[model samples]
Target: MDRTAPPLEVATATPGIAWPGLPGPAGTSLLGLLFQLDRTQWWPAERIEAAQRRQLAALLDHARAEVPFWRARLPGFPPPEDAAAFEAAWAALPILTRAEIQAADASEALLADRLPQGHGEYREIFTSGSTGRPIRGVRSQLWELVWSAFTLRDHLWHRRDLAGSLAVIRESGAGKAPYPDGDTQAGWGFSSAAIFATGPLFSLNVTTPPALQMEWLRRRDPDYLLSHPSILARLAAEVGAHPLPRLKQVVAISEALAEPQRKAIEAAFRVPVVDVYSTREAGYLALQCPDHAGLHVQSEGLRLEVLRDDGTPCAAGEVGRVVVTPLHNLAMPLIRYEIGDLAEAGAPCPCGRGLPVLNRVMGRRQNMLRLADGGRRWPLLSSGDIEKLVAAAPALRQYRIVQTGFDALTVMLAVARPLTDAERAAVIAWARGKFGEGFAVAVETMDELPKSAAGKVEDFICEVPEG
Candidate 1:
């Protein structure tokens, strides 16, 4: 045994057994992959890009030969062997959009004509439909392996306790995970369970009211809580004065974690909030850096790009559209797929990790507010602003802002009771001040604001069509 190795690297020995306890075949394979990932994370940026381009070249070749959609779009010849030429050819390829993927799927042109042997059986995956257009994609066994490896990396990077209980609150179909008394399993699912002896897993449906969810969390008293950022913020508000002392960390997934939400969750739980940027179609994109505020791109499994409208890559601190290509998904190669989200590029991290950094994953373009002058900007509403509004309107439970026109805004409030005239005025005043005086703000009280099928609620949504 290497005593100097990382704690997670050490194998769990069987009781009463001497040195070298069994980790099983599956565990052994996962550990072996993790060992490689451990080293790859430290490889210089140039070395990492060289490796990605090599894999990408093969994927591009396969796409050209097997996938009908790519066959029409990609060059007739294989990807250029030269690194610079390959990059140029890659950049020249059109960005794949969700709508295009849907069209290809309808035409049966998105999937590979044949699978590479030993890649394992195909598994179907569907996006959450948060953008109103859900995409269906196929994943090979190889993709699953990479997903698991990245999942393990996330756990290791956050230094989570595998032996500690995990509570999850996320979208689940009817009868799958019910309210109040959700579901429980013997161990944490997937990567951790496949390799380590873990604690119990508890889950509650995201549709449950925030108050009930908080009550359930207190009862379960799990060491870790995982859910969407919107849910976390609501739960944080429900916390008020009562803190979940047992929670060691909160894992925000699915949606981008806004700065206000992060601060609220951290302040409420008195625990760190780690954001994991991922999609159902493309397993893991980036994981929060353990030592810093930025998120490190999982360059080992995928190629992530932040691009400007001009089709050029964004520099450090510049915001741009997020495009991704899962390097190993040979079954359905989504080369340069635009995931329909915005993000800020980050400078190199001081942590010495070679992986690229994303300063922040801004929400989708539709979430940006469109000004009367035909310009879009992220609506600025600080946590303090929300606190003031809630304080002014004690009956308010939740609120969502929607841009109806270039100069009009609608504020939908879910309240316990009809707000007083002054409370309504306060809400309207806040919206106008946050957005702009030129915009006309209207307030509508409702029993509850509607959440997406995936149990996500955007704080702001722009309905005005882009020019």
Candidate 2:
């Protein structure tokens, strides 16, 4: 596929306007940023790092002067002016965690004493608490502008049709777009619609059953669909029966898109699946490359690091904990915040983009399995293995594995009916073979599996305490 960007075109709201392609003030600002990003994305790695250092210097200075929590931690007022000295000082800073952020938020220690002029009002935001620890922070209007720019950048990178209809199936609060009836808007919400005329956007809460969600999609027949990877997987099973003739692409968000889920969606829907790595607190962490499966970090807006257990940078193809610092967010600057996720670092992409690549996003730290020998590994269950298990137990609809001890696992099965004795033995045998031979595996049947508040269900969960 050609990695070149498409020609810039703006749609006019008024048909008879004298300036057909001219955009409004907001649109003009967005276009200005987008134009600059087009060149910055191709900058060399060294150049990108230099730019990030300059921005980080400014952010650190601001944090030390205005934020109380950072004042004590960031000693040596006014960071070093030399590049090498500054780099050393920056690395010496402690990695911030979710628990500390929550503590600081209670006392307003993380917030800036005063906002910069023209930054505009701030709004308080809370995370989904999927990690068992939700955090609160403030987002300035300036931060929102940067987020919107990145959102537009992702759309442009994929060369998506701006006028195509979009469907969103994610968490929805009360009075927002709910289930059954759902909701529809005249145009795609801000960032895209703020600049260009777009097709209507349809939304439905993800809590709706897969069968109903499929019926809703068949009714709307949208061009693009966006939802969590788990939701997409469940919906994939229904697509074989009720197809969406107009569906062009699927975007998986909120959760890591494993290889099995990706293959299932593409095979069932007969369309490409694009995965986006982002969070509620920090927006647009990494977006899938247009020409490759790897993801490119949004270095223009964030300073992301993949660090080893000893706090050193990971080499190419090394899996490490993800740490991020939103360079543009001044209201609540979370410098070097550990986001509780693991990802594999990659060498420079073949696509020629200077952005860093994440070879694969291995889910959260809690998702790894703990062995009796005090070792850890990501549980591997291939699609073929899953098919074999289903073949052995025809009543199995879905399954989730929960680690109860170092050598014990409980397989929760959502099935149509209780499995026969032979089928039960087969399920247990399969789990033991995949996990470990000496491990104890128990099978429990359930009418259906439970989903998170955000309507996401994980295939594995570790209940054992972390050492």
TM-score of 2: 0.94
Q: What overall lDDT, based on C-alpha atoms, would model 1 receive against the true structure?
A: 0.87
lDDT winner: 1
Q: Which regions of candidate 1 fall more than 4 Å away from where they truly are?
A: 1-21, 76-81
Off by over 4 Å in 2: 1-18, 77-81
How far does residue 91 in candidate 1 sit from its true spot (Å)? Answer: 1.5
Predict model 2's lDDT versus the native. Answer: 0.86
Error of 2 at 190 (Å): 1.8
Q: Across residues 1-467, which tens digit of lDDT does each residue of candidate 1 receive? A: 33432354334545665445457666777889999999999899989998998898888889989999988798743444577777877788889988899998998798998888868888898889998878898989878888989999998888888878999999998767777789999988877766777789999988888889999998999999999998998899888787887888999999988888899889999999999999988889999998898999999999999999999999999999999999999888899999989999999999999999999999897789877677779875788888887876889878889999988999998999999999888888887777778888899999878999898988888888867
**Per-residue lDDT tens digits of candidate 2, residues 1-467?**
34464444586655577455777767778889898899999999888888888888888888989899999998672344466787777778899999899999999999999888867778788888777777887988888888889888888888777678899999888657766779999877887766777788999987787889988888889999999998898889888755678888899999889898899999999889998999878888999998887999999999899999999999999999999999888899999999989999999999898999999898887878987677779885788888878887899877889999998999999898999999999999988878888779999998879887667788888888876
